[model samples]
Target: MAKEKLNYIHIIVTVYVLQLGVDMFRMSNMLAEDFGTNGWIAILIVSIFVVGIIYTIGLVYRLGEGKSIFEILENHLPKFMLYPFYLGVAVLWTLIGTFIGKHYIFVLQMLSFPTTSQSIFNGMLIFLAIILFSMGIYNMVKAATIFFFFTVWTIFVVAFYLPEFEFIRLTTHFFSGGDGYIKGFYRVFVTFFGFELVLLLFPYMQKNTPVFKATLIGHLLLTSAYVIASIVCFGVFSLYQLKYLLVPGLELLSYIELPFVERVESLIFNLFIGEVIVSIGFYFWGAQEMLIRLFRKHSKAKKAKKLTLALIAGIFVYSMQFDTLIQVHEMLHKLSLFHTAVIFGLPIVLLSLLFWEKRKEKKSNAKSI
Candidate 1:
């Protein structure tokens, strides 16, 4: 069977959905607690850093033009280096799955399933992610696009409760401290970490499409969403009140009383399960792609599919062995820097080298001619 071609819009939508995962809704609360009243300013500063990240990510995509990141690395780097790079990415994705799964469990406990075991909840999510990963990228992207719209509609429906927003309380001391704001800015920058997956998705896009435009629009949408969420959390709950909350966005909904529904927050929490599942599915697909490119020589789709299932099963088993969620989160946080380096940093270096080598080759050919 011929491989299906994905256009730029599909790639862009997949990237956007991956980035807007479960984290965005609660990231502001983490930033506010970390940076206090200066969180918004920190978010603004982080947005600037995101521009740099965006440029670097664009370079990675450019380097892998017409090829996936795995293929590009396999062609450019030696086998030894390539294997290590692939391993790093696979480990990073697995760690991400674990981290997100833990958070999902935390959210579930806080909202509805307080009696459930965290391990059981996490195991179930990991199992589901494994199933999704068994499906290839094309299917994953289709599912993501559908979920993306669902999440957007939910966001809008949830926004109607914004009338309960207490602006003065939220803005009581906006931008009071320069130092704290700077620290908060860095935290917000880290929150947008999932955009790095574009490295894997870019090559699958149709040639000559303006990927950067789609990405820019996506980032702007994400920023606006974050800002709105921050305002809602701040306006609805006092700083002291918010500090104790695990997921402030859901808590914000809990305070709202809709005539039609008494437990609107519960509904939003359920929707969030879908959002996180899609997000994890995308990451799992990326990890499988990287692994397949590194270890297998088979170009046949059926063989690749079988290999992907085996790998996901292995990852699921490994995910269950971690004794505690805190250990998993710590490993994820530390490993994320390596992911930043490979997904963002290595691409810039590779692209520069590729460009210089091409220019030199061109000059030599011109002289010879």
Candidate 2:
């Protein structure tokens, strides 16, 4: 088997741009509701915390050098413990991936295709995930590079409606009472979920590259994009009005009309279909990585690919059994806590242990030498 290589810059761009899409366009309003007008401030605070986490996770990756989180676990922990730990991470990502697909399908049904069957919508999304997952990480990174540019173009197009934004709505004092800031900060933390990809992809990064710089730039880009979109949403809709909306970015675009184009939201919504696909693709890939690490025997390239495809298919089937969108959303919210714990908490712990072991190894070598 040949070792696979990816451009460091492309990975950085993909991580940041994909992060922008994961939450920026869909949940800005929900964030604003939690933080009020100061939601962007709360986002900045949460991002600071995220930056610290990314740095620590990057440190772990740098120390391990050329190994995924699973490989690191296998090296440090007993084999029996490795499988259970990896399985927990896999289940966490799978549940989150299913929820993302469910939410996207629900958005499509409500905003554009009211008559479409939920199964058909979910099936299409699963198909996209399978195709991307079938391709190796190198190809996935390439696809993400192309889609990253498209996401930038979409942002510019969405910006065209800025002049029409009602300033009063944006200026209204939602945070005037100075309450809910802590709650809003936590919600913003939840929105930055995809940063965990750094841990999963760190092993594949080019050697000697500045991982922290890439991570920082990516974080800045995503945070800026989210703030801009949140401001746009606030400007276009009153705080009170935005409270009831699920997808405020879509709703904001719904108000803008061009000389020839009447339904701008529909076009934006179509673009969202691609964004959601990429988001889920990354999650699926993360789960696949976890599974590959757990079994230990099937890390061969061909077998790994087969397992990834199978896992995606299995999750899609599970998604189809849910009868209502609300049920999926509720499950997703509950699962997110677990996802955060395993993806973020476990890495921090594992990395600390790895560092301690390395220090012990160094001390022993010094005594021997």
lDDT of each: 0.67, 0.72
Tell me the tens digit of each residue's lDDT in model 1 across 18-70.
76755565765676677656355556567667767677666656654645655
RMSD of 1: 3.1
Please estimate how well model 1 matches the true structure, expressed as its whole-model Cα lDDT.
Answer: 0.67
- Candidate 2 off by > 4 Å: 1-4, 166-174, 177-179, 298-310
The residue pairs in collision within model 1 are: 42-185
Model 2 local distance difference test score: 0.72
What's the true lDDT of residue 107 in model 1?
65
Q: Which residue pairs in model 2 clash with each other?
A: none
**Residue 68 C-alpha lDDT in model 2:** 67
Top candidate when judged by lDDT against the true structure: 2
